[model samples]
Target: MAFFIRWLKAASFLETKTLILDASSYIGGHLFARLGTERAVATYYRNPVGNVVYFDALSMSLSEVVKKTQDITHAVILIGDTKPDSCASDIRKSHALNVESIISIIKFLKERHIKPVFTSTESVFDGIKGSYVETDEVNPILLYGRQKLEIERYLQDYTVDFTILRLSKVYGVSPGDGTIFTSWLEQIQRNETILCSYDQVYSPIYVEDVVDGIIKAIDTGAGGIFHLSGNKPYKRIEMLEMLLSIASEFILQPVNVVRCSINDFGLLEKRPLNVSMVNDKIVKAMGLVPSDARELCSGMIKKFYTNGAMEYR
Candidate 1:
């Protein structure tokens, strides 16, 4: 009986050691907090946060970081260029980090038998269709999406024991989190005219839900592609209206709303119209039911106002 208990402890310890690459990223920060510093070690290029070591995908070696951290079972790769416009403008620079460096890291981890959890984007699918599933054909419109798909394809063809989480637009509750929701709130608070796309559609999942899904994926040893998204698809105009309605309850101010096409933003590439992914795969794998987007927005506003912590910029 004592021998069995000892063996279980050893197994648990071996399985739980995870290394979070790009721990300074928004998702990485939330994940680090959830997993705690002891259970997970982190790597950052510029900002060295809690329990993180320096690792530049361009200049440094991934093996050195791996050598420093022993008995690591999983390495969540979050280091890459995620900006659509930036990727479109400078393909070579972005590809070097997004594709080349990432592939190299995957190879290193694979050689050592460490499972990799890669955070992909819903942008992999073209916007012509909504409610994308794992089996659907992907036609990424944005350069960022294509870059992500490149890695996804590499993983599918070359590696096993990898978790590809194709996430939707992830938003946080904080005011300056830089997500569309909070950024709009900041603009509205400052009485700036908000131009929202009437045709754009997506599943905007909460950061908490994304973090939960990633942690669940790692813990359960679930491999394959999964979509971590909101409960339902929402139009850009509808989402803005929902936020406006919720914000009106907390702040008494006249807000300006301008309806426009996504092209009006002057982005280097055209945005997808309906990149809303279905989270059924993750649901079946981890039983992760995402929080309602409207409810989450309402709760976030309520928390900020009720706590009296919101400062108008």
Candidate 2:
């Protein structure tokens, strides 16, 4: 009874740490839903939290974000999924078109208000010759890459207490979302053959690990651009094969998996042959280790199969 009482007290203490999430996108929504189990929180621009204020980025101006920040202990800005479409074309024009929405929040916060933390991506790197570090020069080749790079530059010039997380390929089991794993899962479930890319290689990070790393960054009040990715790199088809093997365990149906070249898809933009990131900085700074891709895909498959596709939305 004494131990139980002490444990309850410690849990209660953890519930009071307020962190405000801006933009209720993929990672933002996932973080808020997960954090609700253990932390106190608020939101601006979006209601990642059920009971918190929903600051609509479209309707609410930046001053509102500043006002809300004053009341929270920490602020996290998730920059993806803001636009309706995730395609490269929409992403490239997002910053210029959403300038009013972006400036409002910046102006609001600049008035001696709460500090903001921004999330960016490694897509900013062109993936030309080698892996990139935090201090490396950014030369993005794609539209999505360019937009993220612009946002990073804007945020760095706008605020002092900001941290930029340059993420790599993030994979998880979110309902209806077309992650690399899910795309293959969909085809496999339908008893269809999946032609995966053998040439493309990337460092895939599990979404949960990204969240944990972000939480650690928040705790330490660490600022600056940090790489959040898996420890090792895997070819695109190798990852698909791993996912197919895991799915075969619970799923009785056999999936036809085939290797194909990137040219087959005729992707709009030229993708980097190797965009594997080295997350030594974040690991060293936060003493964190990301989970392997195999484990992540297995868990994702299990969740999808158990919950069914309708639960994704």
Candidate 3:
């Protein structure tokens, strides 16, 4: 009995006052539902609020459910469904309305004075120049960017304690399948001509780093807009080459890669050439230096291929 009691104490240390994250709507959608992120986040969530009072922020009302949240000391929202290729109608009919609905949630948190943490993206900028700061001009070039920017603007003068962690290209493996990472691996294995664009340049952060930075923000009570990304910026081709090289080394097979321009792809949305954000603010705030792009990318590759992915044999 004494040994069991001591063991219980050690186990209980990992549990924090319950933290809530809505995902019924956001699940099976974006990077949030991916295996890498879900696995990394499991450590931070002991007795998660979703295990108890379940709520879909987009489908159901956040105001009612947020209040029903028990022992909710802190709430973190990690949901963003829209992207560059999202059609105008999809943005208008769904993504835009989702943002407006989240406002009611913000008000509920304000009533109880619970500081909310929101995830923003680097797409808010036009990417005319790289190494963007928090105060850089936000001329969003895509529908997704417009949606994120709209939310940022709504929170600016609300007299609420909130922290907006604007993220870069977050790379990780999907929980189920068909993530960009998996797709690249599959294409490489099949010896398909991978048309990697040379126009885009951005600092892609690892999912673990982003999750760690978020936990740090929650712990240290950091607020306001902060950029969290890898230490360096890289072109898409450069990054893809690194990924291919790693795969080649692992599977002992050469890859067929094709260098292409962004214009040739005929994409619906105009992608920003340089969406990388300066992580100086987040580094300073957390008093920690972030890993280099190569290191993060390599680690992700290894993890995703550990048990064999959709394509990596």
Candidate 4:
């Protein structure tokens, strides 16, 4: 009975009280759902979904929010204007949230004895080269990437116990998930032309894989930076072609696939062409083997058909 009691105590210690900021966001929502309300606390900005508390970084500080909520051993920050065009258009506002507010939260958490898990993007790389490792030179071309890079630099200099997960493009398996694959599938179903850039290359990871990696990082008490991305690098057009090939088996309508340069997509800022990362650090640290984009696409396509596509049609 005493040995069993000791084992229960150890298990309870492993289950830390995690605070998921911006829990309404895509990644945040998935983490909250996986962790559940019993093991995690969620915060929302506008839409309060699945038992979340209000937390507007523009108005309130992390200290204020922490005071109102339960004690948290770790905080997963998912706040900021993630859109590149938006950040480029309004530099001041986006900078305030992405850099300043994020730093403030990290400082507050560190001061209050809370481990912070920040979700950064793979855009920190300049994309001149593919398959970037953790210790590679970071030169961000887009404004959004610069902002994320700034935080990463700060974490390297300031904190020792921080977990910075630099993620690639994340996609989900559900319908209307607003991921690239799902969006393309919808357009294909409608018989619309899909214009994908041939120059742009990136690693696309499954959302569940990302969630599992984050949990593993937290549970295992991982520190420093880790790249959470897909196993292989693929050009934008290559990924689209893969999707089209798989989609041919299910869809009746024939959709046009157009290949264009990355520059053809007129944006306020220029994007990196190849931001694929080498996820060896994450694999070594967390023992994570991520799913490839093709596998995820096949699963999503099968799920879409099995759930009755005629209703969607």
User: What is the TM-score of candidate 2?
Assistant: 0.78
Model 3: what TM-score?
0.78
What's the lDDT for residue 103 in model 4? Answer: 91
| lDDT (Cα) of model 4 | 0.85
RMSD of each: 3.7, 6.8, 7.5, 4.3
TM-scores for the candidates: 0.93, 0.78, 0.78, 0.92
lDDT score, residue 219, model 3?
67
Root-mean-square deviation of candidate 3: 7.5
Q: Write the per-residue lDDT of candidate 3 for residues 92-173, one digit (tens) a residue.
A: 6556444765676677666655567777789899889888999889998878787888778777878456788888887655
Report clash pairs, candidate 3. 35-175
Q: Which residue pairs come into collision in candidate 2?
A: 62-104, 62-105, 175-312
Compose the digit string of candidate 2's lDDT tens values, residues 1-313: 3223323534665433434554256676667766773464556443343666666665665454344323443456664443223445565356543444455555554553434566667677777655677888788776667666766777788666667788888887665566788777777767798888898777888888888888888677677889988888888988887876777767786667677776567776777667778899999998878997776677777777888855532
Off by more than 4 A, model 1:
1-15, 309-313
- Model 4 worst lDDT window (10 residues): 1-10
Of 2 and 4, the candidate ranking higher by TM-score: 4
Q: Rate the local accuracy (lDDT) of all candidates.
A: 0.85, 0.67, 0.65, 0.85
